[model samples]
Target: MEVELEIKGKKLVLQTGTLAKQTNGSVLVKYGDTYVLCTVVAEKIPKEGLDFVPLTIDYQEKAYSAGKIPGGFFKREGKPTDREILVSRLIDRPIRPLFPEGFNYETQGIASVLSYGDENIADILSIIGISAALTISDIPFNGPVGAVRVGRINEEFILNPDNEESEKSSLNLVVAGTEEAVTMVEGGAAECSEEILVEALKFAHTHIKGIIALQKKLGSIAGKPKREFKVEHGNLKDAIFNIISGKIENALFLQKKLERQQALEALFNECIQNLNTADKDISLEIANAFDKVVKKIMRETIIRKGVRVDGRKPDEIRPITCMIGILPRVHGSALFTRGETQALVATTLGTSEDEQKIDSLEGEIYKTFMLHYNFLPFSVGEVKPLRAPGRREIGHGYLAERALQFVIPSKDEFPYTIRVVSDILESNGSSSMATVCGASLSLMDAGVPIKAHVAGVAMGLIKEDDKVVILTDIIGMEDHYGDMDFKVAGTEKGITAFQMDVKIPGIDYEIFKKALDQARQARLFILKKMYETISQPKELSSYAPRIYKIQVKPEKIRDIIGIGGRVIKGIIEETGVKIDIEDKEGIVRIASSNEASALRAIEIIKGITQEVELGRIYMGKVSRIVDFGAFVEIMPGIEGLLHISQIADKRIQKVSEVLKVGDQIPVKVIEIDDLGRPRLSRKEALKEIEGKNISTK
Candidate 1:
């Protein structure tokens, strides 16, 4: 069966009942030439005593989808790329919240890009595909969510903009929502205003509603009956709550996080002892209900008391302190601390040769700026086996990179590869936002000439019974328990990047607008503090390599890189410097610790490619001696003919007596034949020396 809907003048086709029939639900969605097949499977038997939903969303991209072979030793896709992991998270966030509570039947959804059209984006299409599949599946998902990519071009919003349309856009926003509310949003912009962003969301939601209607119609035709499930607390909730009721208030409000956690744990343990049920099955039931009780205590405390666990108002941010140029040897470095979270950021500067080269479906790309984040166990007050960064770390680093990339100077303005590394020394909450603050300060300390100070803040929300509270700079507890974690980054003027996820069904546009408005205030406040630490980019460090850019003829690139790269290798070895030459427009970058070496390399390049002047004198080496004349290399590769008669003032019987291979001699450019070759003379050079001697007499 197939269902087609037209959204914003584009056709979205969803087809099923043709492939992967064994699964609960499978859908193949195509828009333009792009197609994605998403399948959902569920284990009917629920895992016992599981509180959190066991849902996994996987988004994978095959190279063959774009008519290319995979590039690896295994000739197959290995671990998921950063792009794939993020997409999986995008699909998981909206759908996970819609499942009925206690429905822990181990469901897995997989969305694979079968064919990628150049004009269509696969990420959002995959997001839409998973939603359609789950809606028609037997799983209890209250979703028929729709996703679209919005772009702002010439002050107008474009829905589901393709690659070409996005190129001219100032905003690249992706919004996912059902007809009732918006669930997920992630994208970047060039200092977009809050009003424009809010309008864009509304615009995207209107079109998304149509897509949702199509899914509902499709689900009614092919959807299976949802399995029945019931979880019994078994009088354990009453027993535990009765014992811990008196102590919940004091334990929830301890000013210190550790103290509060300890108190809550001790009280919960006492309640467990009061139950005194030795049956393993009964004990498991009590344990599960206790978690919900704890969440209820936290949420009710915020709602009734109008204050947080840390004795903060709803919109209060944590304490902050920042410093720049803390480390002497590093090109740039800063230490930023917000509340208990701390990030020590270091910036390194390098030559153009240090730029990272990446191969992707789009094309080959070179990145000049990169931000890497490292979250150590010590940062979180725990000890574990150390390894490479996980998906969370990569996602955080990419977020910070997107936020600050807009402020970085272009290659034409400041031509150097920039690397910023953030090491989380202490973490409590919103450490990724702390990274954004630290990276901005470090860039200024390195004299990177950033446009403005960039800072980020995360906001949290609690919604129950038509009441909502937006918390700014929330700690770890609130983030894990709250319904929303909305992070916005930007300068004081406007936003640069936006990322948000909700754990509830969805939040209406009113809540969305309030979050954006509150974040803008926090962003400006953070920026004010950031400027007091480091107002602007200082002078470039003296220890950094001085760079000079030069351009030669496009055809001369290969000549500069001689046969087998010998000529370029010799230059670096002889001068002890680094050089990068680009085939596009013949851009050459020479970087050296000292100015003398750099100047020497430039002069060497000029000697080979520069034209020889008729009257200028040059020191040349006699490369070969023939019967007619001797070939003296005036420069590296430019040779001139020095006849035997021109070898000496006196008639020489053989040129070998005066000149031999590897002999250094001064030669003058006397004339050039019509063939554009140089004719040189050693006799004329000697005559000038004799004339000077006679004139002194």
Candidate 2:
């Protein structure tokens, strides 16, 4: 059946029973020519010990939809690319939060690209489809959430523009929300001010609200009765309230930051000890509620008194300190701390072989730069079970990576594989921004030669009435109390990346612009502090490997490679250097630990390679002397036939009189055959000898 719905001043046509009918809930959604097939399937049982809803969203792309073939070996669909993963995450963020708590069902949401008009993004549509699917499914959700991609083009806001149009815009902001509030946001901007980001969110909300209304209308026609699960509450609630509320009032009054945190922790520990005698099952619930109450109190303090827990002005930033090249053995390292948030970032440079190979629907590709983020429990003054990086870690790492990617030098310009790791030594809020600051410093420390210094700052906003206060370099408490968390990063000339997540329905354009301008001021201050430590990239470390380039004739590429790569392998083994050779078009790169090894590899390459000569003499070895000609070895693995007729000034009857096997002789090149075979003459050598003899006499 085809369902046509009008959403937020746009038309949406969702067609089912036409494509992918096998899935439980599948719909081909069309907003103009861009189309996406959204399907939802639910498992029969819940995942064991899972406290939250296990909703997995997979967004995929096919090359055929884009009218392109997959590149490289194994040219077929593969694992999701980073871009796809990010899109999936965007769809998951807003909808996941809207689901009813304790709904621990295993569910999957897949959005496969059927066609893209090259304009409308599938991200927004996918969010709508997820809501639509759940509306008709047997799952319990307080959704009908709407999503929009907002862009600022020509100093004006645009909602859902084409790809080409978005390229010219300064901002690419994705906002997702319910009718009451925004739940998620992801975007990158062109050095836009905080006010602009906030305004973009407001513009997005207006359109998103319309979409949500359309979803509700559709649900009214096709929605199912939602199942309910009891949220267990016990006597621990009163105990949690008494323990947290008592300390929060005093903790909020403390002016010193560290002292206040200590007091809070002490209170929390005392509460935990009191709960030790109570039921173990309700202990965790009590702790979670206690944390929520603390967050609420913090928010109320900022809203009512206009004072933060740290006792700073509304727009004040925390103390910032930056240090570069902290690790002597590393290629580059930096320690960056803003208030309590600290990150130890390090960079390592390698050859092209070290690049990460990615598999995706687009095709196989190699990424020359990578960023990894790690967060330890100790950073937050907590003791918990240690495990590998989860989805949150991956997502944070990717955000920092994208923010810095705009300024990284291209592979051809800087032929080194770069890997950056950000370790959180302390956490308050905006650790991702801390990673960005640390990465920029570390790159400079490693001598990466970046175009300009990049810095990131997180801005917080508390809105009351028409008045709004924008806080710079927001801490953990401010982030919780604030209505908006706007993060912006860039160099002095322009912006690189920005993300905004709002707790309220949205703010207006004026507020968004104010926030951006305030963020810029904070960002510049942070950049200045960073420059005091390291102004420019240093010379590459001496311990780093050396890379050399060499070019060879295209035809001789196979000869250099030999059978099954034997020739290249032999060179590597002999010189102790890594050689990467391209047979087609002939380009070879040599990377080694020292200059001598690199030069040795080059020597071996030159030995097996052939060079064309117009006229040159060679000291040759006679391999065989026949009646008609003498075969002589000129260069390594190269032989030429010297005719007996041309052996001397006077004709000789037999070749044996002049030359013998295993004899050293001088030969001159007479001509080269069509096949590039050399033709030599002993007669030419004899004439040269006679001339020397006459000169001596």
Candidate 3:
């Protein structure tokens, strides 16, 4: 089966029943020349003892899709790259909330790029294809989700902007939603106003509705009947709630995160012992019920009292503290703490050689600035084996990275590769936002010359029927029980980055606007705290390497680089510095730990590459004696001919009479020959020196 529609002056085609037919559902989506094939499979029987949905979504980009082979010794795809993982998370965030409650089937969705094009990104298409696949499958999903990429250039919003257009756009927002409401939002902007962001979301939703309708049309004809599965924990939940409702409420009102957590755990254990059920697994059911009851109480408390579990009002923010220069060795370091969350962020600066080389389907690209987030188990007071960063960590890191990217100076202005790492020392909620604050502080602390201090705040919403409460800076409990996890990051001017995910169907424009407004208020408060600690970038650390960037003639680049890079290598070894020279641009960046070494390296490079100019006087050394003229070494590796006639005011019997090898004399560049060699005059140089001496006298 096939269906087609028009979106934003482009054709969007969806086809199924022709590929991966054995899967429960499959759909192929094509937009521009990019094609994404999505397939979903679900086990008939639910995994035993599972309380949460085991839904996995993988979005992979095959090198072959872009007509390129794998770039490793194995010559095949290895593991999921960061881009693939981020895309998978993008698809999972919106789709996970759409699954029917208690539908715990072991489900998996795979979206692969079969064809890649520069005109359209495969990530958005993968999302649309997966939504269509789930809609047509037997999986218990309440989804016909729509996704679109919105870019704003010159105050005009462009739907599904291409790569070139995205470069010029100040806003790049990716929104996914159901027919009535938006489900997920992730994007970054150049400090755009809240109204502009709301307008963009409205613009995106208008097109999202059309795509959702198209998915519905495909489902009506080709979708399989949804399977019948129902899970009932209501009776157990009510029984547990009856037993522990009072205790849980009191425990929740405890202000401290750790104290409240311990109190609740003890209460749950007590309730379980009191019930004294025979079925060993009944404990798991009771535990699950206890959690739901807790969620219920928290939500009700917020909706009824308009205050969070921590006793703060819905619009109130947690106490924040910012400190910098805690670490002596690092280039920059800062510690930002809010409520129970803390991030120890550090910055490191390097030369162009430190830039990350990413070989994506589009081609090779270099990233000069990077931010990495690390969440150790100890941050949450858990004991687990250390492992590599998971999807959550990567997603958080990317969001924080984008938030700071707006204020980071361009490479031309500050020619150094920068890296910021945020380590979560303590976590309750909004560790990612803490990372944003710490990263900004550390960048400024490291003397990165950013435009402004950036801060982030996570807003939450609790909606029960008609009552709605917007939270400014939510804690862990509020986020888990709340309907929304909306994080906004930026400078005092406007928003730089934001991410939104809701447990409910979607949020309306009014709610989103209020959330943004509250987030902005919280962000400004945080930024004020940060500025009090460090308002502007400090002087570059003495330990940090100094990088000197210089431009040379394109033709002279080779001369400085010598054959086989021998000359550059010698300079690095002699001065203890790092050098990166761009072949096309003739740009040389020399980095050194010592200022003297950097200056010495620059002098050596200038001596080697600086061109000889006419009428310029230089202190030259006579290199050798020849019959017609004497070769004068004007610059390093550069010699000019000082004819015997120009060597002296009067003609001499022999060249040795006026000058000899190893003799230092003043010489003027009289002319440059056709071959690009300078003709030097010592007599005119002497006369000019004499005139200056007389004037001074």
lDDT of 3 by residue, 1-697 (tens): 8999976566899999999999999999998889999999999988765668899999999899999998989999998989999999999999999998788899999999999988656989889999999999999889999999999987899999999999999999999999999999999999999999999999999999999999999999999999999787558777777788657878989999899999998988887887755765467777777888888888888888777789999898889888899999999999999999999999999888889999899899899999999998999999999898999999999999999999999998999899999999999999999999999999999999999999999999999888889998888888988899999999999999999999999988999998998888888889889999998899999988898898998899988888898988899899999888888998988989898999999999999998888898999889999998899999987899998899888878789777779998889999998998999998998899898862210
Error of 2 at 263 (Å): 1.8
Better of 2 and 3 by lDDT: 3
Report the lDDT tens digits of candidate 1 across residue range 333-430: 99999987899999999988789886566756789999999999998768899887887898899899999989999997899999999999998789
Question: Which of the two candidates, 2 or 3, achieves a greater TM-score against the reference?
Answer: 3
lDDT of 3 at 57: 98
- Which 10 successive residues of model 2 have the least lDDT summed? 688-697
Q: Judged by TM-score, which candidate is best?
A: 3
Residue 175 accuracy (lDDT) in model 3: 96
lDDT of 1 at 656: 81
> What is the alpha-carbon lDDT for the whole of candidate 1?
0.86
Minimum summed lDDT over a 10-residue window in model 1 is located at 688-697
The candidates, ranked best first by TM-score, are: 3, 1, 2
Runs of candidate 2 exceeding 4 Å displacement: 4-12, 15-85, 96-124, 134-143, 148-184, 189-217, 224-247, 253-259, 265-293, 304-306, 465-467, 606-610, 618-627, 630-639, 645-668, 682-697
Question: What are the per-model numbers of colliding residue pairs?
Answer: 0, 18, 0
The candidate that wins on lDDT is 3
